[model samples]
Target: MTPAPAGRDPDARASLPLLLDAVLGVGSEPELQATLQHIVDSATELCAARYGALGVVDPERVRLTGLYTAGMTEAERAALPELPDGRTGLPGALISDPRPLMPQDLSKDSRAAGLPPGHPLMRSYLGVPIRVHTEVFGHLHLAGKEGGGPFTDQDLALLRVLASQAGTAIGNARLYETARRRERWIEGAAAVTTTLLAGRPAADALMCVAERARLLADAAAGVVLQPTPEGGMEIVAASTHGDPGDLVGTTIAPGSAVLGQLLGGEPVFIEDSATDPRMTTPVRERFGPSMMLPLQSGGRLIGTLALPRPRGGRPYDAVDRLLASQFASQAALALVLADAQHDREQLAVYEDRDRIARDLHDLVVQRLFATEMMLESTKKRAAAAPAGDTVGEDTVGEDLARAVDELDSTIQEVRTAIFALQQPPSDAPTTFRGRVLRETGGAAVLLGFQPSVQFTGAVDTLLPEPVAGDLLAALRAALAAAHRRSEVTSIEVAVDATPARVRLTVTDDGRTTSGTRGTTRTWESAL
Candidate 1:
């Protein structure tokens, strides 16, 4: 070590290298939390103090929002009932003044707020405000000099320099974190858009958005709520750590204070959902800080995207609110585009189906009917021939008659295929004919061939919803029974509507216990 001149302080010279090392170490950490803790530890070591803490001030500077401590063992920390909020006593004074503080004997200092139970005793104290570009970031406090003496002017000076370096490090760390957070959100939004545009159902799209937002926001749960017919919002999709079944279907009634804001496409930020009077849902008690952002694009309000944390969780900052709101807007636009694409696809399918149906009715059915008529004519001619004119004239007439019947059945099958092609492909069938086809179509998967379906009278107009439902249930049961039977080759279903009643008849060609070739079941219901 170089010798100090007669008038210079040798202690300052001795601590110079340690101060430089502390400054280099603090700024090197990229993470904000790690940087803060490192600064506290370095400051405590440089000042030869027994305890040190760094309390970060909130944006408003009215209270301490975060605390990092060093020199406290895990057992010592666990023994304390709670950490201080730094809103009172010497810590508060430093935040307010933004100046260095040193007190000889904290027990005698009037500004001292006595420690909580199980806290270590302290006498000397030193505090300094860390500033970043003229704005106070936090305060660093050191207590109990190592040699049982009060903190000196040299220690205060050294602590102040270290605090200045910590400010710069904290700023760098915050910027890095903010940039990383933004990138994650952007990537998440892009992923959601890709999934939606790739063609997902409406329910699946909503759930995708919820899951992505929950992950990006680090929330305990994410949910999407849409307006119901009763002028309220209902949760249709939810993504959570646990089972989300209970959260789905939860509603915000029309008169809720928060409902108005959500419906109007306004964002609502709550510090604590459990205690907020505006939150009326029964599930609110499970969450703490919450953000309800309207998923809207252009002039249409789609729904609300809610991200909520569990109780006692960290509240969201300004950056979080901004990023999340932007994400919601993007997700809404994607949903609209996906819905439009789905409609276009459906229309295309309908056009193709109509063309095929037209071909069957115009060409295929016409040909089959013409063949049946020619066969009938031949059978008649065969019958009219003299008894000795041909070797097998009776056999010829019978063969011609059977050919005509087969042609007639072929024509009916073509017409049924045309009808099946004409119905909408994706939605649940509402009309009687459509529903019957749906039942028969489903059975085909298990039966290995489609059942022949025939409808007599205006079934759709005559049958009530109740009757139709019962008929569908009966048809399902018949199909199931047919599937269970051995040697089943075919199934025939018919629905007849009369002025006073409707009937469903299901017949299957399967060997019965008595070795019968067929079985028939009929269900009748009054109008």
Candidate 2:
């Protein structure tokens, strides 16, 4: 069609070539928001309109998401009750069927009558949809001619060309953004796999997953929940920016839809956990979007990895869900591999311990027993010697008896060491209180019943090693003395370590009525 006469557009038509050049060049703006804003500004300048707004449509085509306005003061825009929902008014027509229109008067249009209370007055209107390829992304709406006349045909034609270029710029910006986001997610998944394979503890492996996933997804919190014996799931590890004492130990019951799916090794995605009927946990109320992925590999279900965003945070897009799911799979494989490595290392340790235990029993115990036998024979010979030599023989016998006692004690200790070495590594004691429990538990085999042991304060951390060793010796002596008594029934041991001192009291019902034979032993040491 022919353009409007020079009499109408006059000076405005002269700048149309430069305007097209500028609009087409906005694709290199690099930033998505800036590129979009520049497009709106270019449209207003090219059309010579007093007010301009670029309404961004939501992905679902439900409503306008954001407004990029030009030629309006910040205060004026802020005073408005709410931004325009472009899909509801005159602009909605463009979204339904994108096309250019320059209405003679908007006040006569019924759809433009329901303006918010603080809206500005306008008459002439021009609008066009900004399409990204085939999708109607949104519309550029302008009103009221700048020079106080109608929008000529030349002005409408100019906007259509600018709209085409704006679409290209917007599309390129989005592609760039998606690429950068995907890069971060890929790197994050790789980091988690590397960490899990580094032979850390099982707990640490889970924690590495939680921390990395939280950062990658930009969620409020990340948690790894392991199945409990009760057919439910309990949070074993949690990663949060602040205090996480409450996140750990949270449980998802057996019957919830989300929990059931996760337990069965299926993934769950919720747009709004706070309102989703399938989410039954109270923690869901604090989150909007969420993803629950099962960590399974080789037909074994490890657990569920959950990432939850804050109550109003943006929902995850298709790309986000896909990347996160793939990350979860890689993480699960890493966890299984890490667990196997740990088991192998532990097996090697146990084998070495068994060899050491055998050497102690076979060599050390035999030698000590042989030496004790020789001492016993020498003592027998001394006791039988004649009266003139009685003095020397008695002295010789006394020395031999003490040596025999020492050898017997050494043999008993070696036997206990062998028993300890033969037990699983988990059974080993890393704390003083644990060692004391080990001692009492061993004594139960001979006592025919278990002893009740009670601890108060931080005995394991606060008690010194030497003082603890002395207490153990006293406890052994008392228990051994009680075992020799007639009809010993029960034993109770208590260790109370305060800031001032550590005290141990061993009381037994087996204490004989003859006080000289058995007694309650109390051992105390100053801190």
Candidate 3:
């Protein structure tokens, strides 16, 4: 085999259509694995090679991390020897130099002396380094052009251009992976929020989050550790393919394993869980690698999320950690908000019950007092009447007695009204004024008169629980005060609410004459 002529124009348009179709055609698609396979196929066809592969470089291990091939049976491709590290073979050499390679004959070349044992079907080879900026990312290798012919200079130029485009595609794929991971995290977070708000138990909510985490991260298992009463940790939830009973309900002492780091409000990464010094039990051997992140809210450590990778899998990368941590934080916040909303609802119920109790007491007591007054007045008038004209006295006594009986019946009717008022509202009213009216109607019987009420300006559209309670209490007080005045004829109540403030006024046409009025007491004293 002879070296191809070197003076061919580097910018030749012969392979431009193929290059454009390969790079720009499927670059932004969501399916990353399929897109990568397309790149390998296009590279092989552009170079007219019988076999081709794109090998992803692993910096840490200094070897091929992943490999995709075209024009080979599955068994044949699987049997290919592994490419080693440190510039040993053609692929490694091209990667290290970050340039193109055009080897005419591999068997006759001294530089290819230590090729891996049992390497198959290679007499001529050509490759180009895929690069991002100045750093070499990987390499694209073509083995033996068709018809046993040497590769032309034009072939190397085309491969180089394709390699450049391939690098951009690889970068785009990585970015797409990141974005997809982020989208999954967001969906998981939303699910956690829904479960928590639906009033699922804390343990159940945590389990839901763990299950989603395992699926999103492609991990073997997931666990949630919550701080215990003894300043330790309790494994409240665990999601895994195997039996989770061993992990669930387990307790970890403070400063024990990765759970401790999480309890201390810091995230921990165990690239090799079996070898880490913190592993205190044989359980760590079950997983080869793992990542643990703290679930925190408002600077407080609420719990931890622990995820374990499958056996023979690489450790979690930066993107995985970022996504996991974000999900953990959202889960924590959801738990907190759910608890807070529940507490607020409970408090509102308590307040409403108390107001109902007070209103019933006021109405019942006032009616009973009026009944007692009517009975006493009748009794005194009957005793003082003369005994002459027995028939006339008897008629007078009968009339007085009938009036007392009627008053007693009215008092019983008022007691029934009070009983109805003692109960809370069954459903939420549509508007704030409607709620206010419902509340005021319950207390109206206590005032002994139907008070005229008017609403001016925009009444409150929706009253917050606190403001509603306050307004109900104030309205009752004002109505009671108006009823006590002898000159009071009509009463009017108004509520004016704006975005900035709420104001209420209660006015009555009532006066205290100099001689007929009793000594006055303040409204606060009555309350």
Candidate 4:
């Protein structure tokens, strides 16, 4: 290749071939770090600077992220002070302002005041804002021009053009990084869900989710909240190795602290928990950055997930929030599913018990009724027999009558046993009116007296489940009360069903010493 012409147009000199080569050179970057390094190197060479630094801006564009750098030894770079977060220095100001800044002497600039302990080699500097459209992505600073002079307008323009290219590359790299992170999070969430759904109990599943969240987010601690019976949150599980035994079992009231905010279905972010106004307890003193995200299932708030970092750690950003929130959502769903499974199991047990009760009632009650009829027939025969065929025959008749009495007592014992067996289980079905009535009968027997229940109209067929359940419960209560009184002789239960409603009446004929001796309690419920 022949020597290039001297004093060529600077724009033309740095354009086309050089830019295309630089862009194409980064195509082989297999990872995000490699891609970022390639871009920084390209930026340095394109601007012809002795030193170059590229800092990725945070989501709010108020902080610099240490990702990649070029043209400095490890020790030299380590010796340099940390870069300012916001639009503090000339470089950050340019990035924030999204404009080219060509400072003749950066060391003397007013904005360069209060430099931290040991800053890198910098003098005449040209800073360009790396931006994609209107959004500023980061800052690119070219320090100490090798030719020894202040950066000219042409240099500023050239840097801006090169910055544009860097912006595109940086944007692509960031996008790639974001997508990879998202993929990893998605896979992690799926794994956690599988682990949770594999019959893990609620506490264990919550702990797994916390561990996975801490690992994925690289957080110092992770906590999971579950709603308690009192509408508060209990920290059921947590990963707090950095400060173990600190946050576990902590009860946070609903809407009281950061955790409460999350449980109330709002995400809470505290850049510094130690100083945040929302932090109400002394426990926050150990943590700096923290995020609380709600865990919900079927639109119902299950609890919260609180992820916190150490006091000196960097603040959490949008990416952290997104990842943590997604994890919380998965954990919420798992918790809800586990709870539902438990409920279903309990219901099944109740159903089984109810079935057994029904079987006993059907088999035992029929036998007792038959026995009662036999006793009635025997009593009739004993009365109908002649006064006395003989004195010895009278003795025989007395023995027969005693035998019938014994049989009657045995029938009463069987009835009592059947009543004891018919008690309703805790989770018994609330729908079936017949089932309810049978349970009411058992309850009545315990109080005393076998209530004579008569269904006047199709009571069971007309009433809805809720109404029927309530009516039956009320009737059972009324009958129990009547049997409790010593004066009550007989209980008569009547259920009347109409098109619009069902009415239940429980009456007892008991002798009141001073008044008309009858007590009636009636309940009417809509279908």
What are the lDDT figures for the candidates, one per model? 0.87, 0.80, 0.71, 0.71
Estimated TM-score for each candidate: 0.73, 0.65, 0.63, 0.63
The TM-score measured for candidate 2 stands at 0.65
- Candidate 3 TM-score over all chains jointly: 0.63
Q: Alpha carbon lDDT of residue 404, candidate 1?
A: 65
**Local accuracy of candidate 3 as per-residue lDDT tens digits, 126-157:** 88888766667688889878889888888887
The lowest-lDDT stretch of 10 consecutive residues in candidate 1 is 415-424
Please provide, for model 4 over 152-175, each residue's C-alpha lDDT reduced to its tens digit, 9 standing for 90 to 100: 776677667667776676667767
Question: Judged by lDDT against the true structure, how good is candidate 1?
Answer: 0.87
The residue pairs found clashing in candidate 1 are none
**Which order, best to worst by lDDT?**
1, 2, 3, 4
| RMSD of each candidate relative to the true structure | 13.3, 12.6, 11.1, 14.7
Candidate 4 residues lying further than 4 Å off, grouped into runs, are 1-19, 59-61, 152-158, 227-232, 241-243, 253-260, 356-527
- The reply for model 1, stretches above 4 Å from the true place, is 1-3, 365-527
Poorest stretch of ten by lDDT in candidate 3: 518-527
Backbone clash numbers for all candidates listed: 0, 0, 0, 0
Count steric clashes of candidate 2: 0
Better of 1 and 4 by lDDT: 1
Report the poorest 10 consecutive residues by lDDT, candidate 2.
Answer: 418-427
